[model samples]
Target: MEERHVIVTYRLDHATIHELCAQLEPDLMSAIRHPTGIPPLLQVLSVLHFLASGSFQTTVAIASGMSQPMFSNVLSRVLSALLKHIRSYIVFPQVGDLPAVKGDFDALGHIPNIIGAIDGTHVALVPPSRSEQVYRNRKSYHSMNVQMVCLADQYISHVNAKFPGSVHDAYILRNSSIPYVMGQLQRHRVWLIGGSLYYSPKKVFQIIVACCMLDNLALCRQVPFLQEDGPAGGLVASVEPLDSEEEEVEEEDIDNGNNVIQQYFQ
Candidate 1:
C-alpha cells in the first residue's frame, strides 16, 4: 500500500520573518538542538496573545489551534529568549543614575531632577486556591497588580509586575523601588509626578517640567486652537471652552420646579 502526502504554503514578508527569527534562541547550537523549529506562527501568536489578550498559555493554545504541550514549549522558548535579551535591555530605566537620565532627556528640552511618571493597571488572574481570601480585591475580582512608571515623554521607566491582587497603590509604591528613588532626591532638583497625594506634589511638578524641557515638546498636546486675527494682524489662536452654564441652570430648574409629590418620589 502507498501512503498519501500533503503540502501547505502561506505568504510572509522577509522583515517579519527576520523579527520572528530574532525571538528564537541566539546561539546556533541551541537553535540546532531543537528538533522542531520554532513554529513561526506560534511565536507570532504568543506575542499577539500577550499584547492583545494578556491570556495564559493554556488559553492562548486553545485559541491559536495548537496542542497544549506544543503551545507551552513554544511560548516558553519565545518568552525566555525575549525576556533574557530584549526585556533586560529594554524594560527598565536607570533608577539612581543621573547620567542616564541626562542622556535620555537632553535633546528634548532643559530641566533637572526628573525621572518618570508612575501609574498602576490591574491584570486579571486566577485566584490562588489556597490563598483565595487574599486574592479577592475590593471589587471582588481576582487580579494581579501591575505598576508602571512612565516619563513625561511617555517612556516607561519601571514596571513592577510581582505584586498581589489586593495590594494598595500606595502600599506598592511604598514597598517598591519608587520610594527609594524619591528618597534619594535630597541634593538634586529632580522630582516625580504621581497621583499619590501623600508624596511631594511640588516635586512631581518639577519632574514634569524637567521632562517637558528634556523632550522639547509639551507632555500632552492641546486641543487645536481656533485661529483668529490678533491686534497686530498676526494669527492668534485659542481653544473653545465647553458651555456648562446651560446644563447647570436646567438642573437647578428641575430641582426647584419639583412639587412635594415629586420630591417624595425622588
Candidate 2:
C-alpha cells in the first residue's frame, strides 16, 4: 500500500508498523509455525483494520483470509502480547524528572509547574456478559471511562483505564494514583489539569492498555492519523482526541459538594 493508504487503513506508517510487528513477532511465531495458521503480520494488520475502521469481524477476517472465529482468537493473542509490554510506553514523569516536564509545559503556555493535562474519554466497548449497566455512560452506550494525561507536546504520559463510564469523574480521580503522587508533593508545584472518569473485566482492561500503548508508540514515532502529511521530518501531533462534543459528559463534583480542586490543593 502507498503511504497515504497505509496511514488511513492502519493508522500507522510502515516503519512504525514494522517495529510493532518486530515486537510482537516472537510471541506470534508459535501459532504461525503451524501449517494451517495465519502469519503474525496478517493477524496484526487484521486487528488494526478492525480498530481503525470499526468494521465487523467478518469484513476484516475475510479480507485477511480467515474465518471470524479464527480472527477473534488472533485478536485476543495480539492484544495480550501488546499488554504485556504496556508499561514501557505509558510512563508517568518521575518525581526527579518533574522539573524538565514542567519546563516544557511552561514553554508551551507559560503555565509554570504544569507538568501535564488530564482528561477523561469514553471508548466504546463491547457489552460485557455481566454487570452491563455500569458500562453504559449517559450517552447510552457501553464504554470504558479512560483517564489520560498528556505532556506539553501532547504525548500521553499516564493512563488510568480501570473505571467504567457510569462512575463519577471525581471518584476516579480520588481513587487514581495521581492523588497519592500529589500527596507526596508536599509543596511541589507540579499540576495535571483536565476533566473526567469502570469496573471492567480483565480482557477489557488489556484491550484498553494495549490501545494506549499503541497511541504512545505512534506519537513517539511521529505518526498522525490525520489525512494531511506533516512537515517533512517534523514532529507530528498526538493521536486525535477520542472524546467528541457529543460524547462530552458534565463532570460531577462527587466529594460531598465541596470543590474537589480546592481539596486537592489544600
Candidate 3:
C-alpha cells in the first residue's frame, strides 16, 4: 500500500479580502454582543467553507480546526447580519423600472414594446427529511424554487427565492411581493414570456385563485392580475411527464431561442 500527501497553497487577493472585511462590519458588531467567543471572520470562514463545499457544519469546523459550537454560532450571526443588510440591495428592481417601450427605439437600438422576462430555475439543496414534504420536488429531490425577472440589458432585475421546490412557479409569482410594487396604482403591463409550466391550466388558475386570496388578505389592495383570457394567457402549463422526443425538442428550442436573444442583445 502507498500513501500520498498533497500540499496546496495560493495567494490571497488583498483588495478582495479588504472589501469583504469592510462588508463584515455589521456582522462583527453583532458578534461582539454574542456570547460565542469565536471571532467573526473565523465564523464567516466556517460558513463560507461550508457553502463552498456543501459540507456539514461539523465537518467544516473539524477541517478548520475550530469548535463546532463556536463555528455554528458565528455562522448564524454573520449570515443573519449580512442578509439583513444586503438583501434589499441585491434582490429587487425599483418601482417603474421596466424596460423602455417604443420611444426613440431604432436610434438607441432598443427593442420596443418589451418590458421584462420571467423564468424559473431550480437551485439544488441538500435533501432534508421526509417531514419536509413541501421541499421535495417531483424529481424526488430537495431544491429551492428560484424565480427571476431579468431586464433587456440581461441584468437580474428581481429574484424570488422564498419558496421551496414543491411550490409551483405560478405560486411563487402570485405570492411574491414584486407585483405589488410594480403594479401599484397604475396599469403596468410587463411582457411576460414563459413556458407551458407558467401557463398550465391548473397553475394559471392556481395563481389567479392565490391572487384573489391575497387581494382579500390585503383588503383588496390591487395586485398584478394574470390575463388568463388575453395575449398573456397560456404562460405556464401543468407539469407532465415528457417523452424523450418532446424533451429534446423543448431543449433545442430553448437553446436556439437563447442564442438568438443573446445575439440580438449583443
Candidate 4:
C-alpha cells in the first residue's frame, strides 16, 4: 500500500476501495482457478492507477506487478463489473424530487428553479487506426466530448459521452433523449445553466443560458485538478438572430431566472 494521499489519488480510500473490490469479487472471480491469475484487489488497483495517472497501460501493468496481457484482461473484467453496478452508485433525481433539488441550488446562490448546470469537456484520446478525423475537435485534438449535468452538491445527475470531440455541446443535448426525459417531468420549470455553446432557448423544457464561469457549483465544490488547469476553455457560440416572439420569451426567462442572484450580490 502507498501513502494516504497516494491512495486518495484513486479517488477513494483504501477501506472503500477494498469494499468495492469485495463486492465485485463475487461476480468477477474466475470459476476455475489458474495458479498465475491476478487477485481481484490487484486487478482493481491496476485499473484505478491507470485511470488516475492516465498512464500507458503497459506502465500501469508493470507497476502493478503483472504482464501487459494479464493487465488488459483484468482491466476488462473490472470495468465490466463496474458498468454492471453503475446504477447503484450514480442516480438522477426523479421529477417528484425537483423541489428538494431546487432548494439545494437556491441555497447555494439564491438562484431559483435551477436544478443543475450542464457543460461539455473534451477527454483526449490516442488517435484510432481508422476514421480518426471524426474525433478531431475544433482545437485539433483527438478526444471524446463528454457532456455532464451536475447538481449543487457536485454529484453528476446526467452524463452523455457518446459524441465525438467534433460535436457541439448544444447538438449533443438536442440529439439526446434528455429532452424526452425532461418532458416527462410535467410538474415544474427546472433550469440548467450552461455556456454560450448550449444557449438554445427554444428548448423550453431544457433551458440553456449563458453564465459566468467562476460562479458554477462545480467550482464551488473545489474539484481537484481544476486549480491546475483553471476553468474549461472552449469557443463561445455566436448569438443567433431570433424571431421577435422567441427573442422576447428568451429575454423574459433569462431576466426572471438571473434577477434574484444578481440582487443577492447587491
Please tell me which predicted candidate would have the highest TM-score against the true structure: 2
Better of 3 and 4 by TM-score: 4
* Candidate 4 lDDT score at position 248: 15
For candidate 4, what is the lDDT?
0.56
How high is the CA lDDT of each candidate model? 0.43, 0.69, 0.44, 0.56
Segments in model 1 whose C-alpha atoms lie over 4 Å from true places: 1-20, 27-34, 37-46, 53-65, 90-114, 196-266
Clashing pairs in 1: 108-214, 108-215, 108-216, 109-213, 109-214, 110-213, 113-190, 117-150
Per residue, candidate 3 scores C-alpha lDDT tens digits across 83-144 of 54444334444444443422323224444544456788655444335546776777886556
Candidate 3 deviant stretches above 4 angstroms: 1-13, 32-36, 53-63, 95-116, 124-131, 151-155, 184-266
Q: Which residue pairs in candidate 2 collide?
A: 118-193, 163-198, 164-198
TM-score of each: 0.51, 0.75, 0.51, 0.67
Q: Of the pair 1 and 4, which is ahead by lDDT?
A: 4
* lDDT, candidate 2, at 80: 76
lDDT per residue as tens, model 1, 29-48: 26323443334434543443
Point to the candidate with the largest lDDT: 2
RMSD per candidate (Å) reads 22.7, 15.4, 18.7, 18.4
- lDDT per residue for candidate 4 within 40-127, as digits (tens), equals 6666666766555544555665666655555555655666566555455545678777999999999998999988788887765544
